[model samples]
Target: MPDAAPVLIAGCGDVGMRLAALLQVHGQRVLCLRRNVAALAPGLPGFAADLADAASLRALPRGIRRVVFLPAPLAREAVAYRTVYLAGLANLLDALDEPALQRCVLVTSSAVYGEHAGAWVDEDTPPAPLGFNGAILLAAEALLLARLGESRGVVLRLAGLYGPGRTQLLDDLRNGTARVPRDPPFYANRIQVDDAAAALAHLLALPDAASVYLGVDDTPLPLHELYAALAQQLRAPAPGIGPPPPGIGNKRLRNARLRASGWAPRWPDTRAGYAALRVDPA
Candidate 1:
């Protein structure tokens, strides 16, 4: 990493903005990079730099000591995942001009744990990806860690993200797509979008941050229970009980490590996060 104080936020989006604000307040200069420069909020220091296009990233601001890469996939398929997550990181690293870059933070997914079959997962668990998303992300994670030799790379495996403007779960319940699986319950884990941002900032500030961390909230609830609660709140018909669709399974994720570090989520559970969406059923 560079000896300078410049921080690079690649693929800056909602979480990126949160990190940018924290870094700025701490008296560090920050640069935001995304595929579309116009999407960047006004007054933000950013430019259009696509990780797919290594050429465009060649001119990324120098003197960057730390980098946080959090890019959304361009498509839903495996190929798209490869392009954005794997190829993107490869291209970004290859194009960096900074030699003082000390640490690179890569935001991945808990899907990499695949079928833990209702078992709890932590940072040290060996990843056994069952699905394509998990496999690809695991591949990308391996690429980043190997490239940086683990010491200078941190992989944050984020759970499902939700918050304001991210009302997909609420929408699912309202639209009757929410399900209540029978005997076997599919466990769900998550972290609020805001907390997701805060976690990244917290990791960046730590001098001895672990190379891998599970970014999850305090509670890991069953999908059936979560849906039932949401349905009752919305005064909608309770979701019908049925078997889970293929590819979904039960798995609990623990964030004891993150909480022990003094970073706690503001919305710890379904109740706290969805309380606002509880419209009067009258």
Candidate 2:
């Protein structure tokens, strides 16, 4: 496939937009599909189409060589979690009929590993998702992997992501209202948005079959320690720490698979990423 063929990004959220920008900078054509075109940054080709609508998606621009499936946001109060998640993915997979499509990268979450407490979990680990969100992600992974043939498909299980315009933990710390789970210091992993984008870029450039890679930093930090450091950087009050609520616990994801693929994260840990955020306040 030519390097200039448009890469289709299904959902143009924070990470999706950043990935599109990086691909655009590298002179790759980026076609972002979303419910709202206004959400995409200017100058990037965007199509205002709903993934829920199969017909509209089937008509995507031609010569799209790569597809990045970012999960669409669901209603917090929606009663049909499985239906929405499966239906959206099914529609997209059905819509693509282009024989030239060579690569597909589906963004799954590390939540599939469930609450790891302090243990390191990798791609090979058996998925034991805890809640509905985790269940849905695992289901999605199965769906994509089942349909993925020799088209160089990939499943990227990303940890908690934090970057510009998408900073919940940092924001909470800066406001001096950050809360930690009551359980003992449990480990959590994260990837800087830019590093995540870089990993995707690297995977796309590779000539291979389907693979499952974990997207996480080298070091996993306790949730409290990360917030504490953030509070110090912001010069705000040391935020109050509490235990994770009943259902929500800590998780540590291993990135050895991706690292072994010759992709090293610029920010290998939450502390480093958080510090950089303070310096530039992203």
Candidate 3:
């Protein structure tokens, strides 16, 4: 990676913005791209483009060495997933100048692994997506590698993302609305948003990064156990017995590959991550 070349982060939202900050702190030039450039901080360079519309991405910045595809779907439907993860990703890759591009990292999800029946999953685990969201994202992952080749194409399969603004778990615990099934032992996997961003930064600088990596933390607890831990931390009542959260798979992810790459999360445990959020909700 050239020190003077800039890293372009497509779909610069909360996590993307956080990544840009981390890259900047390391003396790397950063450029952001998203639909709403006005939301970006003052003096931050960016471009306004809708990934769904290929024509809108024609004016992308040139000489981009590293790219991060991190767009979120506009809706929860299958069409939304296809449009953002598939069509949007295709559009961005087609529009970017590739001569200078060294790597293109796609921020995907662990949902692609589908339900694992409380078993452990790793990068080599075959993807068995169960729903439209996971299916489309899996397709998108294929498309990225097909377009960028194995060396340049990289995927970070992140688990559930939570941080300062994402407080539904806390609210549910406080309101006594949180519930999970205890008999089957549905598992939960998650990584703090800041840690997620840091992982992205870590992969960007890796010279021989693998084609895929699971971006989870050190622990994957059963849903009931996680909620109980959070409730204990909050001094609130335990969650009730009910169906597990909809649309997520039951699996435990291992971060050994990413850890072996010399990138360990600052908060390896979700409990400590949440505690930090409580102390400094920035």
Model 1 RMSD, rounded to 1 decimal: 2.5
Q: Rank candidates by TM-score, best first.
A: 3, 1, 2
lDDT of 2 at 201: 80
Q: Candidate 3, residues 1-282: lDDT per residue as tens digits? A: 436978889999999999998888888888898899999876578889999999999887677779999997899899999998999998888888876778899999987887778899999999998888888889999999888887589999999998879998899898899988998999889999999999999888898778999999998889898888888878888999999777677789999999999999998998888887773223
Q: What is the Cα-based lDDT of residue 167 in candidate 1?
A: 76
- lDDT of prediction 2: 0.76
lDDT of 1 by residue, 171-278 (tens): 777788776675677887878888888888777766777778899988888878877877888887778776764553468889988888779888889556777644
Please list the residue runs of candidate 3 whose C-alpha ends up more than 4 Å from where it truly belongs after superposition. 279-282
TM-score of each: 0.91, 0.90, 0.95
Best by lDDT: 3
- TM-score, candidate number 2: 0.90
What C-alpha lDDT do the candidate models reach, one value each?
A: 0.81, 0.76, 0.88
lDDT of 2 at 233: 76
RMSD of each: 2.5, 2.5, 2.0
Candidate 1 residue pairs in clash (backbone atoms < 3 Å): 1-100, 1-101, 1-102, 2-100, 2-101
